[model samples]
Target: MKAFLDILKPNQLIYPNTVGYDWNQVDVNRPQGHPYYHWLQTNQGEGVVNIDNKSIILSKNDGILITPFTPHKYQSDQFWTTNFITICGYASIFFQKQLGEKKYFVLRESSCVDKDIYNLTNKLDSSCDDAQISLQTYKIFLDILHGVQQVSAEGYKSIPICWEIKNYIDDNYMEKISIKKIGRLFNISPQYIIKVFKQAFNISPYRYLTKKRISEAEKLLISNKDLLISEVANLVGFDGASHFIDVFKRVENCTPLEFRLIYYQGADFNHE
Candidate 1:
Protein backbone atom coordinates (compact mmCIF):
# COMPACT_ATOMS: atom_id res chain seq x y z
CA MET A 1 0.00 0.00 0.00
CA LYS A 2 1.21 3.46 -0.84
CA ALA A 3 0.73 5.68 2.14
CA PHE A 4 0.17 9.32 1.36
CA LEU A 5 3.23 9.93 3.52
CA ASP A 6 5.38 7.74 1.27
CA ILE A 7 6.11 10.55 -1.15
CA LEU A 8 9.53 12.18 -0.78
CA LYS A 9 9.88 15.72 0.44
CA PRO A 10 10.24 18.01 -2.54
CA ASN A 11 13.78 19.38 -2.86
CA GLN A 12 13.59 23.17 -2.76
CA LEU A 13 15.28 25.57 -5.22
CA ILE A 14 15.92 29.28 -5.11
CA TYR A 15 16.92 30.47 -8.57
CA PRO A 16 17.15 34.28 -8.28
CA ASN A 17 16.93 34.49 -12.05
CA THR A 18 15.21 31.60 -13.80
CA VAL A 19 15.74 30.87 -17.45
CA GLY A 20 13.80 33.20 -19.72
CA TYR A 21 12.18 35.37 -17.06
CA ASP A 22 11.35 38.01 -19.61
CA TRP A 23 8.21 37.48 -21.74
CA ASN A 24 7.22 34.60 -19.42
CA GLN A 25 8.96 31.78 -21.21
CA VAL A 26 9.75 28.20 -20.08
CA ASP A 27 11.77 25.41 -21.63
CA VAL A 28 9.69 22.37 -22.43
CA ASN A 29 11.16 18.87 -21.79
CA ARG A 30 13.21 20.17 -18.87
CA PRO A 31 11.85 18.35 -15.87
CA GLN A 32 12.81 20.05 -12.59
CA GLY A 33 12.54 18.21 -9.27
CA HIS A 34 13.02 21.11 -6.86
CA PRO A 35 9.98 22.72 -5.22
CA TYR A 36 9.38 26.49 -5.23
CA TYR A 37 7.16 29.25 -3.84
CA HIS A 38 5.90 32.01 -6.07
CA TRP A 39 3.33 34.78 -6.43
CA LEU A 40 2.18 33.25 -9.71
CA GLN A 41 -0.60 34.58 -11.96
CA THR A 42 -1.41 33.58 -15.52
CA ASN A 43 -3.80 34.35 -18.34
CA GLN A 44 -4.60 33.10 -21.89
CA GLY A 45 -3.35 29.49 -21.45
CA GLU A 46 -4.19 26.21 -19.74
CA GLY A 47 -2.01 23.48 -18.19
CA VAL A 48 -1.85 20.58 -15.77
CA VAL A 49 0.18 20.56 -12.55
CA ASN A 50 0.89 17.14 -11.10
CA ILE A 51 1.19 16.99 -7.33
CA ASP A 52 1.27 13.59 -5.65
CA ASN A 53 -0.41 11.92 -8.65
CA LYS A 54 -3.29 14.41 -8.53
CA SER A 55 -3.37 16.51 -11.68
CA ILE A 56 -4.72 20.03 -11.15
CA ILE A 57 -5.45 22.33 -14.03
CA LEU A 58 -4.37 25.88 -13.28
CA SER A 59 -7.43 28.02 -13.90
CA LYS A 60 -7.24 31.51 -15.37
CA ASN A 61 -6.27 34.25 -12.90
CA ASP A 62 -5.54 31.62 -10.28
CA GLY A 63 -2.96 32.45 -7.56
CA ILE A 64 -1.08 29.48 -6.12
CA LEU A 65 1.03 28.96 -2.98
CA ILE A 66 2.89 25.67 -3.41
CA THR A 67 4.44 24.02 -0.34
CA PRO A 68 7.98 22.75 -0.17
CA PHE A 69 9.28 19.22 -0.90
CA THR A 70 6.28 18.37 -3.07
CA PRO A 71 7.16 16.95 -6.46
CA HIS A 72 5.22 19.01 -8.99
CA LYS A 73 5.44 20.17 -12.61
CA TYR A 74 3.59 22.59 -14.90
CA GLN A 75 3.01 22.11 -18.64
CA SER A 76 1.36 24.59 -20.96
CA ASP A 77 -1.13 23.49 -23.58
CA GLN A 78 -0.46 26.03 -26.28
CA PHE A 79 1.04 29.52 -26.47
CA TRP A 80 1.48 30.09 -22.74
CA THR A 81 1.93 33.46 -21.03
CA THR A 82 2.30 33.99 -17.28
CA ASN A 83 3.77 36.71 -15.06
CA PHE A 84 4.97 35.59 -11.64
CA ILE A 85 7.31 36.84 -8.91
CA THR A 86 9.20 33.74 -7.82
CA ILE A 87 11.07 33.54 -4.50
CA CYS A 88 12.96 30.26 -4.38
CA GLY A 89 15.70 30.82 -1.78
CA TYR A 90 14.71 30.85 1.88
CA ALA A 91 11.15 30.92 0.58
CA SER A 92 10.41 27.25 1.03
CA ILE A 93 11.41 27.55 4.69
CA PHE A 94 8.24 29.42 5.55
CA PHE A 95 6.00 26.84 3.92
CA GLN A 96 8.05 24.02 5.40
CA LYS A 97 7.64 25.46 8.89
CA GLN A 98 3.88 25.75 8.43
CA LEU A 99 3.15 22.49 6.62
CA GLY A 100 6.01 20.18 7.64
CA GLU A 101 6.25 17.25 5.21
CA LYS A 102 2.71 17.55 3.80
CA LYS A 103 2.95 17.55 0.01
CA TYR A 104 -0.07 19.63 -0.99
CA PHE A 105 -2.30 22.51 0.02
CA VAL A 106 -5.26 23.83 -1.94
CA LEU A 107 -5.46 27.61 -1.68
CA ARG A 108 -8.81 29.01 -2.68
CA GLU A 109 -8.60 31.25 -5.74
CA SER A 110 -11.02 33.80 -4.30
CA SER A 111 -8.69 34.58 -1.40
CA CYS A 112 -6.75 37.35 -3.19
CA VAL A 113 -7.41 40.16 -5.62
CA ASP A 114 -5.99 40.05 -9.15
CA LYS A 115 -4.60 43.60 -9.18
CA ASP A 116 -2.46 43.03 -6.11
CA ILE A 117 -0.84 39.93 -7.62
CA TYR A 118 -0.14 41.73 -10.90
CA ASN A 119 1.40 44.75 -9.19
CA LEU A 120 3.82 42.56 -7.23
CA THR A 121 4.91 40.65 -10.34
CA ASN A 122 5.40 43.89 -12.25
CA LYS A 123 7.77 45.21 -9.59
CA LEU A 124 9.93 42.07 -9.83
CA ASP A 125 10.06 42.33 -13.63
CA SER A 126 11.35 45.92 -13.66
CA SER A 127 14.24 45.48 -11.23
CA CYS A 128 17.57 46.83 -12.60
CA ASP A 129 20.15 44.46 -11.06
CA ASP A 130 20.56 41.29 -9.00
CA ALA A 131 20.77 43.21 -5.69
CA GLN A 132 17.70 45.28 -6.45
CA ILE A 133 15.92 42.20 -7.80
CA SER A 134 16.64 40.17 -4.66
CA LEU A 135 15.43 43.01 -2.44
CA GLN A 136 12.22 43.30 -4.40
CA THR A 137 11.93 39.55 -4.43
CA TYR A 138 12.37 39.31 -0.68
CA LYS A 139 9.74 42.02 -0.17
CA ILE A 140 7.17 40.09 -2.20
CA PHE A 141 8.30 36.94 -0.46
CA LEU A 142 7.36 38.47 2.87
CA ASP A 143 4.03 39.50 1.46
CA ILE A 144 3.36 35.93 0.41
CA LEU A 145 4.35 34.70 3.84
CA HIS A 146 2.00 37.23 5.43
CA GLY A 147 -0.82 36.19 3.12
CA VAL A 148 -0.31 32.53 4.05
CA GLN A 149 -0.41 33.45 7.72
CA GLN A 150 -3.70 35.22 7.18
CA VAL A 151 -5.15 32.23 5.36
CA SER A 152 -3.93 30.00 8.16
CA ALA A 153 -5.55 32.29 10.69
CA GLU A 154 -8.85 31.67 8.95
CA GLY A 155 -8.32 27.94 9.79
CA TYR A 156 -9.68 26.80 6.47
CA LYS A 157 -9.63 23.09 5.83
CA SER A 158 -10.60 21.31 2.65
CA ILE A 159 -14.21 20.41 3.27
CA PRO A 160 -14.40 16.60 3.08
CA ILE A 161 -17.52 16.94 0.95
CA CYS A 162 -15.48 18.95 -1.52
CA TRP A 163 -13.01 16.09 -1.96
CA GLU A 164 -15.73 13.43 -2.08
CA ILE A 165 -17.72 15.30 -4.66
CA LYS A 166 -14.59 16.07 -6.66
CA ASN A 167 -13.53 12.43 -6.70
CA TYR A 168 -17.03 11.32 -7.71
CA ILE A 169 -17.13 13.89 -10.51
CA ASP A 170 -13.69 13.04 -11.88
CA ASP A 171 -14.36 9.30 -11.93
CA ASN A 172 -17.66 9.70 -13.75
CA TYR A 173 -17.10 12.84 -15.78
CA MET A 174 -17.55 10.98 -19.07
CA GLU A 175 -20.95 9.74 -18.05
CA LYS A 176 -24.15 11.76 -17.80
CA ILE A 177 -23.38 12.39 -14.14
CA SER A 178 -26.22 14.32 -12.52
CA ILE A 179 -26.76 15.87 -9.14
CA LYS A 180 -29.78 13.70 -8.44
CA LYS A 181 -27.72 10.60 -9.19
CA ILE A 182 -24.92 11.91 -7.02
CA GLY A 183 -27.42 12.58 -4.27
CA ARG A 184 -28.57 8.99 -4.46
CA LEU A 185 -25.00 7.68 -4.40
CA PHE A 186 -24.23 9.60 -1.24
CA ASN A 187 -27.60 8.59 0.24
CA ILE A 188 -28.38 12.26 0.67
CA SER A 189 -31.04 14.52 -0.75
CA PRO A 190 -30.41 16.11 -4.12
CA GLN A 191 -30.86 19.63 -2.77
CA TYR A 192 -28.49 18.91 0.10
CA ILE A 193 -25.70 17.84 -2.21
CA ILE A 194 -26.27 20.86 -4.42
CA LYS A 195 -26.24 23.29 -1.52
CA VAL A 196 -23.37 21.90 0.53
CA PHE A 197 -21.13 21.02 -2.39
CA LYS A 198 -21.48 24.57 -3.70
CA GLN A 199 -20.77 26.03 -0.29
CA ALA A 200 -17.77 23.77 0.24
CA PHE A 201 -16.19 23.75 -3.24
CA ASN A 202 -17.68 27.02 -4.51
CA ILE A 203 -18.86 25.11 -7.58
CA SER A 204 -21.99 23.10 -8.15
CA PRO A 205 -21.59 19.43 -9.03
CA TYR A 206 -22.59 20.02 -12.64
CA ARG A 207 -20.10 22.87 -12.98
CA TYR A 208 -17.34 20.78 -11.48
CA LEU A 209 -18.07 18.04 -14.00
CA THR A 210 -17.94 20.50 -16.88
CA LYS A 211 -14.67 21.99 -15.63
CA LYS A 212 -12.96 18.61 -15.36
CA ARG A 213 -14.31 17.43 -18.70
CA ILE A 214 -13.08 20.53 -20.47
CA SER A 215 -9.72 20.15 -18.81
CA GLU A 216 -9.50 16.73 -20.42
CA ALA A 217 -10.55 18.28 -23.72
CA GLU A 218 -7.75 20.84 -23.39
CA LYS A 219 -5.14 18.09 -23.12
CA LEU A 220 -6.52 16.52 -26.25
CA LEU A 221 -6.54 19.82 -28.11
CA ILE A 222 -2.91 20.46 -27.23
CA SER A 223 -1.55 16.98 -27.90
CA ASN A 224 -3.79 16.09 -30.80
CA LYS A 225 -4.38 19.50 -32.32
CA ASP A 226 -5.58 17.84 -35.50
CA LEU A 227 -8.80 16.88 -33.75
CA LEU A 228 -11.83 19.13 -34.09
CA ILE A 229 -13.06 20.94 -31.01
CA SER A 230 -16.31 19.02 -31.23
CA GLU A 231 -14.38 15.77 -31.22
CA VAL A 232 -12.36 16.93 -28.25
CA ALA A 233 -15.58 17.86 -26.46
CA ASN A 234 -17.14 14.47 -27.11
CA LEU A 235 -13.97 12.73 -26.04
CA VAL A 236 -14.27 14.49 -22.71
CA GLY A 237 -17.99 13.58 -22.36
CA PHE A 238 -19.61 16.82 -23.53
CA ASP A 239 -22.36 16.38 -26.10
CA GLY A 240 -21.17 19.17 -28.35
CA ALA A 241 -18.81 22.08 -28.84
CA SER A 242 -21.41 24.73 -28.01
CA HIS A 243 -21.92 23.37 -24.51
CA PHE A 244 -18.18 22.96 -24.04
CA ILE A 245 -17.46 26.47 -25.28
CA ASP A 246 -20.03 28.07 -22.98
CA VAL A 247 -18.59 26.37 -19.90
CA PHE A 248 -14.97 26.61 -20.98
CA LYS A 249 -15.22 30.36 -21.42
CA ARG A 250 -16.90 30.72 -18.07
CA VAL A 251 -13.97 29.06 -16.28
CA GLU A 252 -11.09 30.08 -18.57
CA ASN A 253 -12.28 33.68 -19.05
CA CYS A 254 -11.67 33.33 -22.79
CA THR A 255 -13.01 31.48 -25.80
CA PRO A 256 -11.26 28.29 -26.89
CA LEU A 257 -9.77 29.96 -29.99
CA GLU A 258 -8.26 32.77 -27.99
CA PHE A 259 -6.81 30.41 -25.42
CA ARG A 260 -5.28 28.25 -28.11
CA LEU A 261 -3.78 31.27 -29.87
CA ILE A 262 -2.06 32.55 -26.75
CA TYR A 263 -0.95 29.23 -25.28
CA TYR A 264 0.39 27.64 -28.45
CA GLN A 265 2.74 30.53 -29.22
CA GLY A 266 5.19 29.78 -26.38
CA ALA A 267 3.69 26.62 -25.01
CA ASP A 268 5.54 24.39 -22.53
CA PHE A 269 4.82 20.68 -22.31
CA ASN A 270 5.64 18.19 -19.52
CA HIS A 271 3.94 15.02 -18.33
CA GLU A 272 4.35 12.71 -15.33
Candidate 2:
Protein backbone atom coordinates (compact mmCIF):
# COMPACT_ATOMS: atom_id res chain seq x y z
CA MET A 1 0.00 0.00 0.00
CA LYS A 2 1.18 3.52 -0.81
CA ALA A 3 1.64 5.79 2.16
CA PHE A 4 -1.45 7.79 3.12
CA LEU A 5 0.45 11.06 2.60
CA ASP A 6 0.96 10.02 -1.02
CA ILE A 7 -2.84 10.22 -1.51
CA LEU A 8 -3.07 13.87 -0.45
CA LYS A 9 -2.41 16.74 -2.82
CA PRO A 10 -0.05 19.52 -1.88
CA ASN A 11 -1.30 21.59 1.07
CA GLN A 12 -4.18 23.95 0.30
CA LEU A 13 -3.02 27.49 -0.45
CA ILE A 14 -6.22 29.09 0.85
CA TYR A 15 -7.21 29.72 4.48
CA PRO A 16 -9.60 31.72 6.65
CA ASN A 17 -8.29 34.87 8.33
CA THR A 18 -11.13 34.94 10.83
CA VAL A 19 -14.16 32.81 11.69
CA GLY A 20 -17.34 33.32 13.73
CA TYR A 21 -20.20 30.90 14.29
CA ASP A 22 -23.46 31.13 16.25
CA TRP A 23 -23.30 34.90 16.70
CA ASN A 24 -26.54 36.82 17.06
CA GLN A 25 -27.15 38.27 13.64
CA VAL A 26 -27.17 42.04 13.50
CA ASP A 27 -27.28 44.89 11.02
CA VAL A 28 -24.18 45.94 9.15
CA ASN A 29 -24.08 49.45 7.63
CA ARG A 30 -20.95 49.05 5.55
CA PRO A 31 -21.75 51.33 2.61
CA GLN A 32 -18.18 50.67 1.66
CA GLY A 33 -17.71 46.96 2.27
CA HIS A 34 -14.84 45.51 4.29
CA PRO A 35 -11.72 44.05 2.72
CA TYR A 36 -11.24 40.29 2.12
CA TYR A 37 -13.80 37.79 0.92
CA HIS A 38 -16.48 37.45 3.59
CA TRP A 39 -18.63 34.34 3.65
CA LEU A 40 -21.67 34.73 5.86
CA GLN A 41 -24.42 32.19 6.43
CA THR A 42 -27.58 31.97 8.51
CA ASN A 43 -27.74 29.48 11.34
CA GLN A 44 -31.32 30.18 12.32
CA GLY A 45 -34.25 32.57 11.67
CA GLU A 46 -33.72 35.02 8.74
CA GLY A 47 -31.64 37.92 7.48
CA VAL A 48 -31.23 40.24 4.50
CA VAL A 49 -28.41 41.69 2.43
CA ASN A 50 -28.75 44.75 0.22
CA ILE A 51 -26.31 44.95 -2.65
CA ASP A 52 -26.24 46.53 -6.10
CA ASN A 53 -29.87 47.73 -6.06
CA LYS A 54 -31.64 44.80 -4.43
CA SER A 55 -32.45 43.45 -0.99
CA ILE A 56 -31.91 39.67 -1.02
CA ILE A 57 -33.92 37.76 1.58
CA LEU A 58 -31.78 34.99 3.00
CA SER A 59 -33.36 31.99 4.68
CA LYS A 60 -31.98 28.83 6.20
CA ASN A 61 -29.05 27.19 4.37
CA ASP A 62 -28.58 30.41 2.43
CA GLY A 63 -25.04 31.84 2.37
CA ILE A 64 -23.41 34.67 0.47
CA LEU A 65 -19.80 35.08 -0.50
CA ILE A 66 -19.14 38.80 -0.72
CA THR A 67 -16.19 39.65 -2.89
CA PRO A 68 -13.64 42.06 -1.44
CA PHE A 69 -14.71 45.70 -1.03
CA THR A 70 -18.11 45.42 -2.67
CA PRO A 71 -20.39 48.09 -1.25
CA HIS A 72 -23.06 46.32 0.78
CA LYS A 73 -24.92 46.06 4.08
CA TYR A 74 -26.98 43.35 5.82
CA GLN A 75 -29.58 43.36 8.57
CA SER A 76 -31.38 40.88 10.76
CA ASP A 77 -35.07 41.76 10.94
CA GLN A 78 -35.72 39.44 13.90
CA PHE A 79 -33.82 37.10 16.19
CA TRP A 80 -31.49 35.79 13.53
CA THR A 81 -28.42 33.68 14.19
CA THR A 82 -25.41 33.66 11.85
CA ASN A 83 -21.88 32.50 11.14
CA PHE A 84 -19.15 34.08 9.01
CA ILE A 85 -15.53 33.80 7.95
CA THR A 86 -13.01 36.15 6.38
CA ILE A 87 -10.58 34.44 4.07
CA CYS A 88 -7.08 35.34 2.75
CA GLY A 89 -4.04 33.43 1.57
CA TYR A 90 -1.73 32.78 -1.38
CA ALA A 91 -4.58 30.93 -3.10
CA SER A 92 -6.93 33.95 -3.14
CA ILE A 93 -6.37 34.41 -6.86
CA PHE A 94 -7.29 30.78 -7.51
CA PHE A 95 -10.47 31.16 -5.46
CA GLN A 96 -11.41 34.16 -7.55
CA LYS A 97 -10.88 32.12 -10.68
CA GLN A 98 -13.25 29.39 -9.49
CA LEU A 99 -15.75 32.01 -8.30
CA GLY A 100 -15.84 33.65 -11.78
CA GLU A 101 -17.67 36.96 -12.46
CA LYS A 102 -20.15 36.83 -9.59
CA LYS A 103 -19.60 39.77 -7.22
CA TYR A 104 -21.49 37.75 -4.61
CA PHE A 105 -22.71 34.21 -4.71
CA VAL A 106 -26.01 33.06 -3.16
CA LEU A 107 -24.71 29.59 -2.45
CA ARG A 108 -27.51 27.05 -2.00
CA GLU A 109 -27.59 24.41 0.74
CA SER A 110 -24.59 26.17 2.26
CA SER A 111 -25.17 26.24 5.96
CA CYS A 112 -21.55 27.06 6.68
CA VAL A 113 -22.83 27.58 10.20
CA ASP A 114 -23.08 23.84 10.80
CA LYS A 115 -22.22 22.29 14.17
CA ASP A 116 -18.95 20.81 12.81
CA ILE A 117 -17.46 24.19 11.92
CA TYR A 118 -18.83 25.72 15.12
CA ASN A 119 -17.29 22.98 17.26
CA LEU A 120 -13.92 23.42 15.59
CA THR A 121 -13.95 27.16 16.23
CA ASN A 122 -14.98 26.55 19.83
CA LYS A 123 -12.10 24.10 20.40
CA LEU A 124 -9.42 26.42 19.00
CA ASP A 125 -7.12 27.53 21.81
CA SER A 126 -4.13 29.83 22.28
CA SER A 127 -1.78 26.85 22.11
CA CYS A 128 -2.65 26.19 18.45
CA ASP A 129 0.18 27.48 16.24
CA ASP A 130 -0.28 29.38 12.99
CA ALA A 131 0.38 26.29 10.88
CA GLN A 132 -2.13 24.22 12.85
CA ILE A 133 -4.86 26.83 12.63
CA SER A 134 -4.11 27.49 8.98
CA LEU A 135 -4.47 23.81 8.10
CA GLN A 136 -7.90 23.62 9.74
CA THR A 137 -8.96 26.89 8.14
CA TYR A 138 -7.89 25.59 4.76
CA LYS A 139 -10.12 22.56 5.28
CA ILE A 140 -13.11 24.79 6.06
CA PHE A 141 -12.40 26.94 3.02
CA LEU A 142 -12.18 23.86 0.82
CA ASP A 143 -15.51 22.54 2.16
CA ILE A 144 -17.17 25.84 1.32
CA LEU A 145 -15.82 25.71 -2.20
CA HIS A 146 -16.98 22.12 -2.55
CA GLY A 147 -20.53 23.00 -1.48
CA VAL A 148 -20.57 26.05 -3.77
CA GLN A 149 -19.29 24.13 -6.75
CA GLN A 150 -21.70 21.24 -6.17
CA VAL A 151 -24.70 23.53 -6.07
CA SER A 152 -23.41 25.49 -9.06
CA ALA A 153 -23.19 22.29 -11.08
CA GLU A 154 -26.33 20.44 -9.97
CA GLY A 155 -28.68 23.30 -9.14
CA TYR A 156 -30.16 24.46 -5.82
CA LYS A 157 -32.42 21.44 -5.34
CA SER A 158 -29.60 18.91 -5.52
CA ILE A 159 -29.18 16.86 -2.35
CA PRO A 160 -25.82 16.35 -0.64
CA ILE A 161 -24.85 12.90 -2.00
CA CYS A 162 -21.29 12.71 -0.68
CA TRP A 163 -22.41 13.08 2.92
CA GLU A 164 -24.72 10.09 2.64
CA ILE A 165 -21.80 7.94 1.61
CA LYS A 166 -19.58 9.47 4.28
CA ASN A 167 -22.08 8.67 7.01
CA TYR A 168 -22.40 5.15 5.71
CA ILE A 169 -18.65 4.69 5.81
CA ASP A 170 -18.44 6.12 9.28
CA ASP A 171 -21.03 3.69 10.56
CA ASN A 172 -19.80 0.57 8.76
CA TYR A 173 -16.04 1.06 8.73
CA MET A 174 -15.50 -2.10 10.75
CA GLU A 175 -17.18 -4.23 8.09
CA LYS A 176 -16.15 -4.99 4.54
CA ILE A 177 -17.38 -2.31 2.16
CA SER A 178 -17.35 -2.01 -1.60
CA ILE A 179 -17.79 0.87 -4.00
CA LYS A 180 -20.42 -1.10 -5.91
CA LYS A 181 -22.27 -1.85 -2.69
CA ILE A 182 -22.19 1.85 -1.83
CA GLY A 183 -23.49 2.77 -5.28
CA ARG A 184 -26.31 0.27 -5.04
CA LEU A 185 -27.19 1.36 -1.51
CA PHE A 186 -27.15 5.05 -2.40
CA ASN A 187 -28.59 4.53 -5.93
CA ILE A 188 -25.56 6.18 -7.58
CA SER A 189 -23.07 4.73 -10.02
CA PRO A 190 -19.63 3.43 -9.07
CA GLN A 191 -17.83 6.05 -11.15
CA TYR A 192 -19.97 8.76 -9.61
CA ILE A 193 -19.27 7.36 -6.15
CA ILE A 194 -15.53 7.81 -6.71
CA LYS A 195 -15.98 11.24 -8.23
CA VAL A 196 -18.09 12.79 -5.49
CA PHE A 197 -16.34 10.95 -2.67
CA LYS A 198 -12.94 12.07 -3.87
CA GLN A 199 -14.16 15.62 -4.41
CA ALA A 200 -15.60 15.84 -0.91
CA PHE A 201 -13.08 13.90 1.20
CA ASN A 202 -10.05 13.85 -1.13
CA ILE A 203 -9.88 10.06 -1.00
CA SER A 204 -11.58 7.00 -2.47
CA PRO A 205 -13.92 4.82 -0.40
CA TYR A 206 -11.42 1.98 0.02
CA ARG A 207 -8.73 4.31 1.31
CA TYR A 208 -11.15 5.96 3.68
CA LEU A 209 -12.20 2.59 5.06
CA THR A 210 -8.58 1.62 5.53
CA LYS A 211 -7.81 4.81 7.37
CA LYS A 212 -10.93 4.41 9.50
CA ARG A 213 -10.01 0.85 10.34
CA ILE A 214 -6.51 1.94 11.27
CA SER A 215 -7.83 4.69 13.49
CA GLU A 216 -10.10 2.23 15.35
CA ALA A 217 -7.24 -0.22 15.56
CA GLU A 218 -5.09 2.42 17.20
CA LYS A 219 -7.74 2.87 19.88
CA LEU A 220 -8.04 -0.87 20.43
CA LEU A 221 -4.27 -1.17 20.59
CA ILE A 222 -4.02 1.47 23.27
CA SER A 223 -7.13 0.78 25.33
CA ASN A 224 -7.13 -3.02 25.36
CA LYS A 225 -3.61 -3.87 26.54
CA ASP A 226 -3.95 -7.68 26.50
CA LEU A 227 -5.42 -7.98 22.98
CA LEU A 228 -3.10 -9.72 20.56
CA ILE A 229 -2.14 -8.02 17.31
CA SER A 230 -4.20 -10.61 15.42
CA GLU A 231 -7.21 -9.84 17.63
CA VAL A 232 -6.79 -6.14 16.95
CA ALA A 233 -6.60 -6.86 13.23
CA ASN A 234 -9.72 -9.04 13.34
CA LEU A 235 -11.75 -6.53 15.29
CA VAL A 236 -10.90 -3.86 12.78
CA GLY A 237 -11.94 -6.11 9.82
CA PHE A 238 -8.44 -6.80 8.61
CA ASP A 239 -7.91 -10.28 7.12
CA GLY A 240 -4.72 -11.07 8.96
CA ALA A 241 -1.96 -9.63 11.09
CA SER A 242 0.58 -9.41 8.24
CA HIS A 243 -1.76 -7.50 5.92
CA PHE A 244 -2.81 -5.26 8.78
CA ILE A 245 0.83 -4.52 9.63
CA ASP A 246 1.60 -3.65 6.01
CA VAL A 247 -1.30 -1.19 5.77
CA PHE A 248 -0.78 0.21 9.27
CA LYS A 249 2.89 0.92 8.46
CA ARG A 250 1.95 2.63 5.19
CA VAL A 251 -0.53 4.92 6.91
CA GLU A 252 1.28 5.52 10.25
CA ASN A 253 4.97 5.21 9.28
CA CYS A 254 5.37 2.44 11.86
CA THR A 255 4.23 -1.15 12.53
CA PRO A 256 1.31 -1.77 14.91
CA LEU A 257 3.61 -3.30 17.50
CA GLU A 258 5.99 -0.38 17.16
CA PHE A 259 3.13 2.07 17.65
CA ARG A 260 1.94 0.27 20.77
CA LEU A 261 5.48 0.05 22.11
CA ILE A 262 6.20 3.74 21.52
CA TYR A 263 2.81 4.83 22.89
CA TYR A 264 3.30 2.87 26.14
CA GLN A 265 7.05 3.55 26.54
CA GLY A 266 6.81 7.19 25.42
CA ALA A 267 7.30 8.10 29.11
CA ASP A 268 10.85 6.72 28.89
CA PHE A 269 11.73 9.60 26.58
CA ASN A 270 10.95 12.01 29.48
CA HIS A 271 13.60 10.32 31.59
CA GLU A 272 16.20 10.97 28.89
Q: What lDDT score belongs to each candidate, Candidate 1 first?
A: 0.53, 0.69
Candidate 2 residue 81 Cα shift, in angstroms, is 1.6
In model 2, where do residues sit more than 4 Å from their true spots?
1-15, 155-272
Worst 10 residues of 2 by lDDT: 1-10
State every prediction's TM-score relative to the real structure: 0.43, 0.51
Q: Write the residue-wise lDDT of candidate 1 on 62-162 in tens digits.
A: 54555534456777766655445434532233345433355544444523434443443454456454333444444444445445544543432445665
lDDT of 2 at 132: 50
lDDT of 2 at 259: 62
* lDDT (C-alpha) at residue 93 in model 2: 45
Residue 217, model 1: lDDT of 66
Query: Per-residue CA lDDT of candidate 2, range 74-169, in tens?
Result: 997699877777776544544674456678877766754454357456545344544455555555665776666555545422437877887798
